[model samples]
Target: MITTLRFTMLFAAALCAAGCGSDDEPAGSGTPGTGATTSSQASSGTGSGSSSGSGGSGSGGTGTGGDVTTTVVVNEISAKGSDWIELGNPGSAAADLGGFGLCDSDATGLCNTGDALRFPEGTELGPGEYLLVLGDQAVEVGPGPHTTCLAEGPSSCFYATWKVSASRGETVFLISPNDHVLNQLEYPMEAAADGQTWGRLPDLTGQGGVTAPTPGAANAAP
Candidate 1:
C-alpha cells in the first residue's frame, strides 16, 4: 500500500464467503457467516462520501507522513457473515511486508494507537496473493506472518485489540514502514450492518462496494 489521504470510507457490508472467514480454531471446524456486520457504499477521492475514481491501490490510510509505494492494499472488509480483514498485493513483484502495521479505532471513535499490530520481520505477500486476518482476539498467533493463528488450512488470521462494528461503524488504518498512513477505511454502520461485505472486485485497484465474500481469493458477486 502507499499514499496519504484525508478520508476513504468503505462500506463494511461487502464480501465474505459462505463462511465469511474461519472464526473457529483450525479451518473447517470454524463457523462463519456470523461475525461483525457492514454498511453500504465505498467512497474515494477527497471527502468522505465522494463516489468517483479508483485512486490506485495505495490511496487511503491513517495519519499523515512520508509517502511510500507498496502494492499491498486493504482489499476486503467483511463485517457481516463474518469479521475479517483482507489484504492483497496488486503489483507484479512480491512485496516485502515486513514492519507494516495496522490498527482499528474503537467501534465508536478514532484509533487508540495502543491497539496497533505490527507485521513480523520478513513478512511477504506474492503478487496477486490474498491474505485473510480473522477478527477474533481469542485465537493465538502461530507461524504465518508477523503474528497470526497457526498455519490453518488457508486463512491464518492475526488478532487485534478492536473489532469493527456493524451497528456503530469502524475505521481501520494501514501503515507503511515509515509509519505513514498507507490506507484508511471509515465506513458507516448502515453499510457495515447491511451488505454481506464491502470489498474491491477485480482485486486491489477496483471500486469498493457490497459484494460476495471471497477471502484469500478475488472479490466477486454472488
Candidate 2:
C-alpha cells in the first residue's frame, strides 16, 4: 500500500513538471503569427511604393525646349543720282519683306509725311540675301531699267518712283509691316556726293562711310 502511494505521488510530480514546461515555452515557435506576417508585408509594400515615387520624380525633371528669335536690318544706302537702299537678311532663315515700309525722314529725323513705300506681296529675302530699291533717276544708270537691266537677263533690283534728296542728305527709315521702326540712318548734306555713295563699311554691322556705288551688291570697303 505504501509503495502504491509513492508511485501515485511520483506520477503527479511528473504531470506538474510537464504542465510548467509547456506554459513557460516561447510563443510562435512552431508557426508564424498571422498579424505579424501581415505587418511585414505592409512594410515591404510601403518601401516599394516609395521607390516608385522616387522614380517618378526623377523622370519629371526633363522638360520642353527653348524659344527662337529672328531679325532683319538695313544694310546699305546710296544717296547719289539713281539712289538705292539695300536691305540685308543676316539671319539663318528667309525673311518675308512683304508689306514692309520705307520712309524719307525730314531734317529733324522725324517722318512727317506718314507716307511710306510698301513692298509688294510675296516679297521675300533669303538668308544672307540683299534687296535693292532704286530711285526714279537711278534707273537711267547702273544696270539700266529693271526690265532689261540684268547682265544675266534677270535682275535683283526694284524701282522707287521717289528720289532721295541729294543736297539736303535726308534721314532714311526702315519700317515693319506693323509700322514699327526697324532701323534709321541720318546723313548730313555734305555726305551726299554726286558720284560717291555713303554706306555701311563692313556690310550689316559697320559704321557708314563714303564708298563707290554698290546698288545690287554688298557695300564696298570704305
- Per residue, candidate 1 scores C-alpha lDDT tens digits across 82-199 of 6777787777777766666766664344444556677777677888787777664543553234344334315355655456776766666666655555555555565644447777
**Candidate 1 — what's its lDDT?**
0.58
lDDT tens digits, residues 1-222, model 2? 999999999999998887655566776556555443211001112111121111111111122211111245555667765567776665666766566666666445564335566677677777767777765534344332245332421275666555567676665555555554455555546684677776666665565667677665777864
Any runs in candidate 1 off by more than 4 Å, and if so which? 1-65, 106-110, 139-155, 192-195
Best by lDDT: 1
Q: Could you tell me how far off, in angstroms, the CA of residue 91 lies in candidate 1 after the best superposition?
A: 0.9
Clashing pairs in 2: 82-138
lDDT of each: 0.58, 0.55
* Highest TM-score against the true fold, candidate: 1
